[model samples]
Target chain A: MIQLDHITWNVSGRTILEGVTVAIPANTYAVLMGSTGCGKTTLLEILCGLRQPTSGRVSLDGVDVTDLEPRERGIGYVPQDLALFPGLRVREQIGFAPKLRGMAPEELNQRVNRLSEQFGIAHLLDRLPDMLSGGEKQRVALARALAARPKLLLLDEPLSALDESMRAEAVSLLQRVQQEHSLTVLHVTHSSSEAAALGTLHLRMVAGRLEVESKG
Target chain B: MRLNRSNLCWLVLALITVSYLVFWALLLVATATYSTPDSWLQVLRSPEIRHATFLSLVTCSLAAGFALLLAVPVGYLMTRLEFRGKSWLDAALDIPIILPPLVVGLCLLIFFQTKVGKVIELAIPFTYQVSGVVLAQFVVAAAFAIRTMRGTFQHLSARPEDVALTLGCTRFQALWHVALPAARRGMVAAFCIAWARSLGEFGPILVFAGATRMKTEVLPTTVWLELSVGNLEAAVAVSLFMVLLAVLVLVAVRATGEKV
Candidate 1:
């Protein structure tokens, strides 16, 4: 479970997120919709510890994690840019976090292989991110985020850059991944189609205020 | 090969680039013609030339190594961190690059005259010593390396590091595994530029380290010394050596997949 208690964030005296409070249960795919600059990404950053709220407390599983670093917060984050490392191959990028956490070689390799197969990027294991297409990079980025097996996943506009054909495929792929992994996911997007497809808990943001639209 | 306007533009640019290459080729040819095998052997066998060559290699390498060590942290700080006076600090980093090398050497000379300098000199005196040559070279070369490295970091997106942090690695681990590896080509370019600059540094070393024979002399100072004593052939020989060294460094940088 994740709780954002009165999370208010301001930068340079301008409010980006104003007293936003929300609670998300485990295994719920929460979809957040907001127009450009409506604090969707800001909220994700705050949740993942990339940025801090001016005044708020974040509790995860009944424990306050407001003061913890991103690495210690036990969350997986994928930004809008995908940020796939250019130097690392697809396999290395997928296994990066787990390798950093000292997972054994055979286990890490097996995990990478399994994720690659699930993501349909097993053939691109030796290729760099720059060589991967938009959809391929998206899959690799998702695999990388899941490599560490975090309890929560934060994605910011993951499929927005893909073509229509790729977007439909990705929507199904993401839905399957979320259900199969039982991952608590907070996905931010401006597209209603994406929100409707994957959102178990639908929320909307208007001028820094969050409103609950529907719950499944 | 047509006489069209676009072809004319291409021809002009090609000629300009070729002209530059020809100028360098002509200089190498002139130096080779002037320096006979016997004269080359004589210059190579001379104790003073040999000592200067060895000292130049040692000091320039140390300076470049030290510059790299300083550049990595400074570049990362300048790129990743924002604090009060960050813009001011960024502008201040260019002072050494823009200031005259002789002025930089003069500033160092003046610095060592102060009370703080006296204390530092007690431990490691740098005025008119071989270490002074390294210091002089490092002061200027580090500025260039820092500039190059900062540009490198600026071109790279910070999102990868952010992702790494969200994963399981600490900040330092993120930098080591992701950032540094991404910056490898830039690092090679910076080091090569700094090394070449250090090798050719003259004004600062001449002002601070002094162009003494068999002492603090590097290749550039060796040329000046040889020329001053009416050894034009020897000076040309040293000049050719410097040119060859520069070309070697450039080739190495290119081999590492970075354009000069």
Candidate 2:
């Protein structure tokens, strides 16, 4: 379980998030929705250890990870831009985690191949991020994130950049991937339709608080 | 094409570009024509020429290498950081580039006269010494390297580094694996520019490291030395030599398959 206790973030004397508390059980998909300035991204950053909460604790799987670095916290994050490394090919990008951790070559190859085939990005292994289209890049980003196999996946408006046709496909792909891996996800988006379609647990950020709504 | 505003603008820009290239081509032709084979052979075989050429290579290479060492961290900090006095810090990084090269040399000369500089010079003196040549070249070259590196880091998105961090790589790993590889082209360009800048550096070297005959004489100072003795052909030959070296560097860099 991921537990956020009394998370309050104040920036330059302005309260972006105040006393925000929430709990997400393992393998649950929580869709966090709010307006542009409602601090949804800030909350995601706090969860991912990119930003520390002013007064709160972040617990991951019963361990207090509030003080842990982003790497140590075991959280996978995909920002709105997808932030793919242009220099690395899709295969290298997907296998970055195992490569960094010094996994054996055969095993690393196996892991990358498995994720690539699973995500249907095997054909794009040799392609760079710029060569891929919007939907392809989305799938590659997801594959790269899932290659590490974190306990929690944090996505900030992952589908916002997609065209109308691609957005629906991306949503389905995300749903299928999350379900197949039994991954716990916290996806922040401004689209109610997206929240309704993918959220197992619906939550909204109003002013500076998190309110749990009915499950979609 | 007709002389529409857009076509006219294109024509003007093309003419300006051609005019700049023409100036350099004209100078190269004149230097090559003026420098005869006998004079070139004499200058090439001369002990002073050999010494100056060797010293120029050694010092400029050292300067460019050291400039890169300082540029990477300073460039990264300037781009990827937010701190108090950041604006001032940004401006400070540009001081070397903005100051006249002569002023830079004068400053170094003055600095070595101070207590701090005197203490430093006591260990290994810089002014009017062999080390001063490399130091002078580095002071000017490093600024260009830092500027190029900053642009390199900025051209690359920070998201990849952030993603690398999330993927269990530490900050340093992110820089090494993701950021560095992405900025390789830029780094190469920066090094070449710094190398070229150091090769042609004159004012600072003249002021700080005096043009000692067999000690601190580099290519630029070689030109000055030959001219000072009224050896016009020798000076032209040295100038041609520098031009050839720069061309070789540029060609080698371009052959690396990365645009400068």
Candidate 3:
């Protein structure tokens, strides 16, 4: 559960998010729809602890998480770039978080294989990031981010980097995976259709103010 | 039309570097292992030569190890922190790099002769000894390693480490398991280049370590000592040793970084 109240963040003194408040219930999907430069990604980053809000209170599961570090927020964030480590193999990449958390090798391998199989990425385990197709890369990135089973998952743009064919396929895959994990999601993107496809709650930010859209 | 000509001219100028590279290669080959069978055997068999080479390796390894220890933390702090006097600290690291080798050596000599010398000597065995060579090498190698590594870390995104942290890894764990592993190629490259440079370091070693025959005579210092004493053959022999060490480092460096 993420409860963001009166959040304000400024980059280089230019306000990105101004007094925005939102609550995301655990296991519920939240999608944020906005135009370019709408601070959608910034809000996602702030919630994950990647960027600090200039002024605000962020509570996670009723605990104050405002000053917490991004890693400490129990978030699995997939940035716009998909940000896969180029040097790491698909299996190595997916297993990185658990390795960092010092999970036993056998345990990590089991969890990684289970996630890989679920995402249909088991065959591409030894492949490099470049070798994977667009849809495949997206799945690998998601699997890597979700490896640790974080409470919240932040996706900057689910299909932004994919071609039209891959994008359609990946969107459905993302929906399945999110539901399977029972994750609280903050999906940020420019497409209303993409948001409507996964969102239980919708948010729109224009001119630095966050507005809750009317329920469909 | 003019841009095409300029591009051709730039390629020509870049190709011109091959001439000097070939010349250096020829120079190294002519002296390496020597033409005569006895002299080659002498280099391997002579206890003085063997001991000096051993001492050089030991000292250079120690210096390179120390440089790595100091460079990683210093590089990380400089790259991550925004503290007062940060720029000054960067400039300080570059002091040995920009300063002429002879000037750095001279400064070290003066330092050892003064009150600071006594303090350093008391702390670690140094001044006109093998330890002195290690200290001199550390100053030069650490500067180069830190500069290279800091740039490497800056080019890398902090996102992967952040991702690791979110999965319950601590800050230090994220750095060790994720960030540092990602930087494996660069770190290895830095270490090899620094080791190569230290192995071939001459001026600072001469001034601070005093080329004390078997005690302080590293390969480069041995070459200088032999040449200054008018033994050209011995000088060429030691020169050959230094060149081999350099080529090994070059090959090691090329092997590590995969251009990902």
TM-score of 3: 0.87
- lDDT for every model? 0.91, 0.90, 0.81
All candidates: interface RMSD? 0.8, 0.9, 2.2
Q: What is the DockQ of each candidate?
A: 0.81, 0.76, 0.56
Q: lDDT score of model 2? A: 0.90
Tens-digit per-residue lDDT, A74-135, candidate 3: 88988887878757899998998788778899999999999999999899999998798878
Can you rank all candidates by DockQ, best first? 1, 2, 3
Sorting all predicted structures by TM-score, with the top scorer first, yields: 1, 2, 3
Candidate 2 chain B weakest ten by summed lDDT:
B251-260
Best candidate, lDDT-wise?
1
Question: For candidate 2, lDDT tens digit of each residue in B1-260?
Answer: 57899999999999999999999899888888986888798988899999999999999899999999899989998888878999998899889988999999999999999999999999999999989999999998999899889988887788889889889988889889988988888788778878999999999999999998988999899999878889889999888888888888788668644444
lDDT of 3 at B100: 93
After superposing candidate 2 on the true structure, give the runs of residues whose Cα lies further than 4 Å from its correct spot: A10-15, A163-166, A207-209, B1-38, B109-125, B247-260
* Cα RMSD (angstroms) for every candidate in the order listed: 2.8, 3.1, 3.5
lDDT, candidate 3, B95-192, per-residue tens? 88899998888888888878877887788867887788998888898888888678768877877776666666777876677668777777887787
lDDT of 3 at B52: 74
* Model 3 chain B lowest lDDT segment of ten: B32-41
